[model samples]
Target chain A: MTGVIVTTINLTAIYALVALGISLTWSGLGFLNLSTGAMYAGAAYGAWLVATNISSNVVVVLLGGVIVGAALGALICLTVFLPLDGKPNWELRTLTATLALSFVGTNIYLWQFGPQFKQFDPLFDFIREFRIGETLVQPSKTGTVIATGILIAIILAFISYSRIGLGVRALTQSVEGAALVGINRRTTAFAILGVSGAFIGLAAVLLGQIYFVEPNSGYSPMIKGLIVALLGGLGSLRGAVIAAFLVAFAEAVTLQYLGGSWVLITLFVLIAVVLIIRPRGIAGVLEGTRA
Target chain B: MPRGREDLLHYAGLAALFVLALAVPFAFGTLSILGSMGVFLLLLSWSISWRRQGGDTLAGVRDRSAWLFWGMAGVIAILIPIIAGTSYFLAVMVTFLIYLSWNVMWGLVLGTAGLQSFATVAVAGISAYVAGYLSVELGKSGNLACVGGGERILGVPVFQWWVAIPVAVLVGLIVGFIISLPAIRLRGIYFALLTIGLVELARAYVVQDKCNFGGGQGLYGASSFIPESIAGDLAGYQLAYVAAAGLAALALIIYWRVNYGRLGLLLRTARESEPVAEVLGTDIVRARLWVFLISSAVLGGAGGFYIAYYGSISPSFFNFSTVLFLFSMIMIGGINSPRGILVGTMLLMYVDKRFVDVDPPEARYVFIGLLLFVVTIVARDGLISIPDQIRRRRGVQGRGTNPEGDPPEDVGAIEQEAHMPPGSRPEPS
Candidate 1:
């Protein structure tokens, strides 16, 4: 049905946004950035505060979330990444630092906002949806899909063509080589993490309109993002996009057929089966990306 | 100092600490106060031997020393409940022991095998759930069939505290095997991420299925060491402490056997370099799988003890917070050091118990989080490695040579080398 299709696309867009954030950071910075979840929650709260106090305009709300998310990302970069960059076990150490960051961030949110769920007012009331074959599509979801598509396209283009993106690509390929080319690793890392954090923020804002935001809101999405990133292979952008759709489809189908609780269970089973068949994930098989 | 004098000093310090631990009950005489003193004594003893890595190479001395340390610690652990004379303190110690055992097994996977897996909690959680369900069901039906108050399964009583331990081990092995299926194909972050997802899966499945998994309240009325007739009495507390201490001893033995045994050597080789290990004819995957299975069994036993200790199992056992707490404990302890893990567990447990009275409970987590963040940045190997770092700084001893021309054999160095992307490693200038 059109309703299910719309939902699936919406879920896919959100997952892609999160997955792209994870994938980009891992490739560019050699850090897993598990704190993405905290960033997502922080961004959602930012968007919520903006919508509640300032303006409910879509662009304003989105920017509010993106800026807060980017700031938090940069915060993590400053606190965790910069000090530990190039250190021994940078990957695992950064991962632990990020995990610790999330723990701190989540608790801060809990302390400040309390544990109650906050709902977002409709941000896409101007949009209209058309019915197809007795199934009515949701306008909010339609807006999310279109908005996320444009944002992802813009991010991909930025990563591929922009000067900073070039440096990030170089860093991803080889840190020493990028250094030799005079790329400021610290500034470049900030840019990379900030952009990815913005991506997660945007996803959180888009999803906020659909779901309530809370302190622990980002944990599930972070898990979903990790699933997509893992199945797509850690650093492969194209693979992440493809895996996003795959995971979203599986999640949507399971949610529809088995109920909401079964979504994660089904997706995990899917990842397990897929990863068993191709250990490196779909991207590892298709693009031969490093695991 | 001469070697003989150094050895004498170590024993003298350990003996003095044993006396201190023995004196803890009389000095503080209360739950929190007494527990704090006991923890401090344990830390002091651990720190004394922490820098003596040289002694670790001498198997006989190390074994005898470890036995003396653990044996004394075990005695103190057993006596704490009786001396405290409060069921409340016993309950806290029991929980601490469970987490200690659980974290130790997790250390095996993360430290020894060098796989950053998070399914340790999930394995233990599953074991707890299964053991609890089995005990409840078997106790109800088997009691009727046997015409006795207690039922026996494999010569272990269905409702007994120790019964869950073995059952949990079996469940853990099965779950560990299943989880390790995809583990063979994946390595490093990919595998770690997968394990995290698995934890989420287990949590969601348990939470969503209210009918089967008891919804949010979780499964209850499972058998424990404490009898219903005297569940609130001092005897019940003593029994629980003794059972937990026994489980902790078993876990320590398992950790020692696997970590010091040939499997640990094989894993060290595989962790150093997979291709080289393959060239040397070591089945890296099988070795990891074996490690995973053994650790999982230990985790399962811990989980089994959890149900018996608490008389219930909940979805929160598989929570993200639980994972963070356990991970922080291991990381703080020096993920690779068992003795450090004990230190980490004791420190974190004390901090957690100490902060239980703080208002706006989130502050406690923030404090713990800040502690973890600071430690991760400041000490690469955790609190346990600080002494070594200090010694190195003062030029007491120089860095050891790596005969294989590899990076320094520190925890992070090896993990970094093992997981680095092919071109990402800096070329020799």
Candidate 2:
């Protein structure tokens, strides 16, 4: 039971980070950055590279993932979002383009990294495991959960209170109106994507501790993030966060009771039921604003 | 008078093309080095010299040469298996036809219906598994290789190859209806994402369910239209190839009837503005559901053919990479254009089979991805629109002085309108 709780909290943290990234990009840029998975994979590989070559200090490893993830995000923004923005069928085109870019990104990673799964040196070696009542808790997982909470709190605070956040909100409300007020859509897009990429990058590092980092590792996280973002509503950060927790709890419990194979089936059924009930999702924003 | 002369000329040209196609099987006999080179050069020249307009080119030739083109294509498709004859290329052509059939239906879902449901392969794969299970494993004539140990399932009738196709169709319809549920409610990317999740769900279920789905090892020895005694022979592959060609032709017909038919018109109007389409009493959702169901049923049948041809299937069929490959084919082909779909599938297959035979083996995916990325970025509508883009570019540069360029007057107007957002453009009056 404790294991399930720990797993759920850890998964919630990772899913929230990725879901927030997707939600932020969709609302801010009106682009469903499908390469979010590629960014996640790239970030994990980046952190792995750092742990192997440089010191495995937790901060240094995470910074590597964040930096690489942000770079990939910026690359996508320039390559896919920037080039295809304002084009005819912008939504569909960008969606397809980003998906194509992900294929490219994943293959490039596979080409460069080979197909071997890599394990990171335990980053939380200094922290020791402890017990709460009869439950034995591993320190790395606890550390991951707490660190993710702090990082997400910081990201959420920045998005909620910062000047750039204001720009993103305005742009999400109306592109033309925001542009009319001298808000640069390009800059806002870059910033949002970059930050979201960093968020998922950190997620990659954290999750990588639990799972093997491979060329294809990003896909599951990407799919999970997409589901959470859609369930919470495309642009609703709060809804995404809430949806992340709900999904994580469901997944962990399914894994605990129904076994891992049935997890996705149950999750899909749950998502379909929810979607049928709430067409716009829990807090579906940008309903009338977008086509 | 002149009309008779024109018709005579058209008949003469078509006859010459037919003769050329008939001679191809005997002429090349195999996909040799020199033969492939010659074919490459011929196709390059043909594409370059083809009409330069966008969809209008097809519309322009619709009355005159459209039938001629399709007829010629049909002849070549029939000849391909004979041309490849027992060579490894025959297998490639068979797979190509199957993918062509699959992509045509997927194009309907993506381009015509404007829904990005990514569960196409899942629908096909699930149908194949179910059909293969029912017909091969539990049928009255069960194979010894199956888990049933040749014992027929209780109360089940003889499910031979004939029953497999219809069983697949029924399964495809059920799966299609289920996937379309969210599509009816959710719009755009949400439906796409949900379908993506559903694909993962399917993969997980198949991989985990060992008894029924055969887990990762996959079920083998599927019932084929060809007799079991000769299934391993060259004749079996040839027959399968012909059947596959027939299937591709059937899918093409479906694509035509749905896209050019009344449902396509209503869907297009709905695609533009659903509220407006609703106001016009279009029953847009019903139209979408019908298209989705039709395409899904055909794809399910194709899936049945897939297992029949390959004799087995595994969970890999439901993998996201397969979805990527299929989507790339659609992207590289101009979406909704049958000609583009054919061109795209052939080009990708050529590259997949011939070019980029590199170490690590997985590098081919990189090539495919790059091809897709480049096409998506540059062509936007896939490789089909490249000729138009070139003509528009030349018209801009030469101001109609260039002999090959289209008229410059409306080219500029078309370019301007093309670049503008559809909503911002003046409503067509």
Candidate 3:
């Protein structure tokens, strides 16, 4: 039972980190960026390459991941979003374009890194394991949980207080309203995307410590991010955080009782049920008009 | 040139293209680059001439010209197997036809209905699995002396392929209906994401259940629709080609009927503006449901054909990449054009087949992805609209109107207006 709780918490933290980016992008831009998974994977590979070749320091590796992910996010904004901004059918066009970029990024990963899995040197390996109520807990897992919690709190605070974050919030409410208020929509969009990308990059570093990273590693995490973001409501940061824990716990319990293979099947079924019951999601506000 | 002479030239061009398609297969091998290039050039020129004659419209001259073009295409399709004269080329042609069938079904939902569906592969997988399982079960019963040499279902002998096709379609309709129950609640990108989740769920269920689904090793030794006695060697390939082509023709006919009929109008109306469609008293739900059922049924039938041709089914065969490839083909060709589906499928499949020989196998994904991105950005209507886009860019005023005669509304503008707070609706673009 304790093992399950620990695992659930750890997963919830990591998933929340990933979901933050997805939620932010959706609310801020009204764009469903499907390339988050590719960004995650790219960040993982970037961190792995840096750790293996340059320095084993945790900070250096994490920074490398952040830079790579932010760059990717910015590049997408410039190449796809910037050119097609304010166009007719922008929503569908951007969605398809991001999906294409996702596939292309995965293929690039396959070409450069090959199909084999790579891992970062464990930063917390030397730390002693702790026992909580007869359950053995790895320090790395605990470290990740703590670190992710801090990151989420910081992001929440940043979004609440920062000027650019306020611009993002205004855009989320109404793009025209934001423009009327003199917010630079283009620059603000770029900044929000970069910050979201940095979150995904940080999540990637945390995830890479727990599992092997591969060309296809981004897909599963991307799916998880999507589910959490939808479950919490597209733009609700608090809801995403809460829903992340709920989903993580559900996944943990399912994994324990139903076995490993059934986890994804159950998750999908859960998502379908949620959509059926509450199309706007648990925390989503009604758009009050036909979408 | 006079209108009569221009029409005459269009018909002659189509005839020459048909003759070229017939001769190319025999002149060089089917896979030869020269043959492919020659056929591509001829088809392009023929289409341009047809378009120049305004064949897309319903005018009397264009109507006859449309018939002429389709008739020539039909003749070429019929001549392919005979001209190739080899099972290898026949097999390739069969693959192309099968993909075309898949795309035509997709075009109905994604193109006409404006639903971004990712469930085609999932539905196809279900159909193929059912057919393969039934064939294996019957084969087992026959070996046990429970039935005669002919295929038997529950101790009753029957034409297995005949049973398989309809059953697959029925299953597809049922599955499509069930998916739609949850699907119709979501809008836009959410709907597309839900389909992706559903697909992943189905794949997981298949992979995890080894006993029934054949697991990772997959099922084999299923009976083929073509009997060994009649289908000796190349004959089987020829039969597959003919069956697939027939199916493609049927799909095209269905596509034509839907696009030109009352159903097409309702679907397009709902797609463009659901609120307007509702105000007009259209039963949007019924229209969408019918689209789903028809599309799913066709996809299921194609799946049955797939199992018949390959004699096996596996989870890996219907993975995410397969769905993406199908989507890309439709998007690149022309989502709204039935003919565009054929052209897109052929072009992408050709690129895929040739890319197999490239040093790094994965590079093809990048190429395909880039193509999809570029096409989506440069030509919002896909490859079919490239000519129109060029004409517009060349300052051809009044030619910017879509062939369908509907003025292109700014989708973003409408969405923004809809979501804008009361008293703040933007002025209509």
Best by DockQ: 1
- In order of lDDT, best first, we have 1, 2, 3
Write the residue-wise lDDT of candidate 1 on B6-103 in tens digits: 87887787667656656755665555544454465446545655646542321111234455546656666656665675777777888888888888
> What is each model's TM-score for chain A?
0.95, 0.95, 0.95
Candidate 1 lDDT score relative to the true structure: 0.78
Please provide TM-scores, in order, for all candidate models, with all chains considered together.
0.88, 0.87, 0.89
Q: Considering TM-score, where higher is better, how would the candidates rank from best to worst?
A: 3, 1, 2
Docking level of model 1: medium
The lowest-lDDT stretch of 10 consecutive residues in candidate 1 chain B is B54-63
DockQ preference between candidates 1 and 3, better one:
1
List the global CA lDDT of all models.
0.78, 0.77, 0.76
Off by over 4 Å in 2: A156-163, B1-65, B140-157, B355-357, B388-429
Better of 2 and 3 by lDDT: 2
Q: Which digits, one per residue and each the tens of the lDDT, describe model 2 over residues B212-235?
A: 767788777676787767676788
How far residue B125's Cα lies from its native spot in candidate 2, in Å, is 0.9
- Between which residue pairs do clashes occur in model 1? none
**lDDT, residue B389, candidate 2:** 56
